[model samples]
Target: MNHYNLSSDLELVSMLKDGDLTAFTEIHRRYYGVLYSHAYKRLPDSEEVKDILQELFICIWNNRETINIGSNLPAYLYTSVRNRILNIFKHQKIESDYITSFLHFAHQNEPLADEPFRIKELVAIVEAEVSLLPPQMRLIFEMSRNSYLSHQEIADKLNISSLTVRKQINNSLKILRVKLGTHFFMLFF
Candidate 1:
C-alpha cells in the first residue's frame, strides 16, 4: 500500500472527497503545525488557538465533499484559519459588550439595595412624629396626606371648613418640619 504521507495536496483532497479517512489524517498531520503557528501569532491564548485549529480540521472533514481546493491547499487552509480567528474576535467583542452592560446595570441599581430600608426608617420617624401631634391635627393630616384626600374632602368629612383643614395641615407640616428638619424631605423628594 502507498503511504498517505507522500501524497500531494491534490491527491489528498481527492481522496478526502472520496471519504478516505487515511488521506484526511495525513492532511491533518501535514498542515496542523503551520496552521497552528499562523493562528497563534494572532491569538496568544493557547486553548483558543487549539480550538480554532481543531474546528478548522473538523470543517474540512465535514465539508470535504463540497470543498474545492483546486491547486493551493495551503492557501485554503490559511484562509480558513484566519476566518475562524476573526469570528472568535467578533464573538469575544459581543461577550465583552454584554458583560459591560450587565456591570453598568448592576452599578446603576446598587443604590436601590439601600433605598427600601431608608424609606422604611424615614416612614417610621415620620409616623413617630405624627403620633406626637395633637389628636385632631394628626387625624386631619393623615386623612389629607396618607389617604390622599383633598382639603374639601377632609373639611366635608370632619364637618369643618376647607380653610380650617388647610390651616391645620399647614401647622402640622410646620411642626414636623421643625422636628424632622430638612434632610428627610430632601431625601424623599
Candidate 2:
C-alpha cells in the first residue's frame, strides 16, 4: 500500500490535466481524509459527509479542464472546504447540528482519521468545478465567496450591473446544487 504526499499535488495536477486517472487516485489517496474531516466538522452527520465527498470528486473530474492550481494546492483545498462549509452555515444551520453530532466522540476514534480524506476529496472537486465557471461567474464567486462580499457590494466594486451580480450568484448556486445534490437538501429549506 502507498501513502500520499502534499508535495506532489502540482505533479498530480499536471498528470490529471493530461487525462490521467491514476494521478487523481493518487491525489485522492493523499488528501481525501483531510477534506472529509473538514466537511465533517461542518456537516456533522456522517452519512452526508460520505455523499459530499463523492460529489466533490465527481465535480473535480467533471471540471478538470480549466483549473489553475497556482502551487498551493493544500491551502486551496482547505479554503474551498471552509467556504463550502460556511456556505452551508449561511444557507442552512450547520453550526448547531454540527455540535449535536459530536456528542458521540469517544466511540468514533478510528473513524475520525478517515473523515479528513473524505472532506479533502470534495475540496478538490469544488476547486475544479469553480474553475470551470465562466470568467464573470468566477469573478462574482470569488468576490462574494472568497472575499466575503455582499451582492450589492460586489456589484458596486466590480462596476458591473447588479442583475449581472445576481445572475452570476444564481449560476454558481445552481451548479453547486447539481454538483452537491441531495447531500445539500438542508440548504433549500
Candidate 3:
C-alpha cells in the first residue's frame, strides 16, 4: 500500500503543489466519494457529477504549480463541485426560459381557429363580385390580378391600348368596390 494514503491533507496538498503525482492521486482517492455524494445531492445525475469531479481534478493538476488551497483540500473540492452544480442549474434555467419564450411567440403568431374558414368565405365573396363585372373588363382584371400581368401585357394580349386596359381595370375596381363595400374590398384587393 502507498504511504500517501495515510498522509494528512496539508501534507498531500504540499506534495501536490510540488508536482507529486502520488499525492494528487491520494487526494483524489480520499475525496472523490464525498464530493460525488455532495454534488449528486444537488445535481442527481451520475454522469454530470462524474464530469464535474473529473474537470475539478484536471484543473488542480494543470494548475498545481500555483494552486493555493491553504491546507484545506476537502473545503476547496467541495466548493468547486458546488459552484459547478450551480452553473449547471443556471444554464438549464436559461435554456428553459428561451424555449418558453419561443413557444409563447409561436402561439401568439398562430392564426385563430376560424381564420381559415373566414378567409375562404371572404375569397368566395370577392370572386362572386369580380365575376359580376362586364365580360371584357372582367377578363382584363383577372389578367392583371390573377395572372399578375401588367397593363401593357394585357393590352398586347387583348389587342387594345395600354390606356384602355388601365381604364377597364379601374372601372372593374370601382364596380367591385360598389358591390363589396370599400372596407371589405380593401381586405382582399
Instruction: Report the number of the highest-TM-score candidate.
Output: 3
For residues 1-189, what per-residue lDDT tens digits would candidate 1 score against the true structure? 223433667777899999887677667655555566556766788999999988888988999899777675756776677678778877884455446666899888755468546555534443445444454645543462335566797677667788987776566445544554653253335
Give the C-alpha lDDT of model 1. Answer: 0.65
Candidate number with the higher TM-score (1 or 2): 1
Per-residue lDDT value at 31 in model 2: 55
Order of all candidates by lDDT, from best down to worst? Answer: 3, 1, 2
Residue 165 in model 3: lDDT: 73
Error of 3 at 42 (Å): 0.6
Q: Which runs in model 2 stand beyond 4 Å of their true positions?
A: 1-7, 93-189
Error of 2 at 57 (Å): 1.4
TM-score of each: 0.47, 0.45, 0.48
> What's the lDDT of the predicted structure labeled candidate 3?
0.65
User: How do the residues 42-118 of candidate 2 rate in per-residue lDDT, one tens digit apiece?
Assistant: 57878767776777677776777776665756665566667666666666643566445556665565453675576
Which candidate leads in lDDT? 3
In candidate 1, which residue ranges exceed 4 Å CA deviation? Answer: 94-189
The residue-by-residue lDDT of candidate 3 on 1-189, one tens digit each, is 224433677777898888887677657655565566556666688998899999999999999998778755655666677678778877784455446666898888865479556545534443445444454645543563335566787677667798987776566446545654644345435
Worst 10 residues of 3 by lDDT: 137-146
TM-score of candidate 2 relative to the true fold: 0.45
Candidate 3's error at 161, in angstroms? Answer: 99
CA deviation > 4 Å runs, candidate 3: 94-189
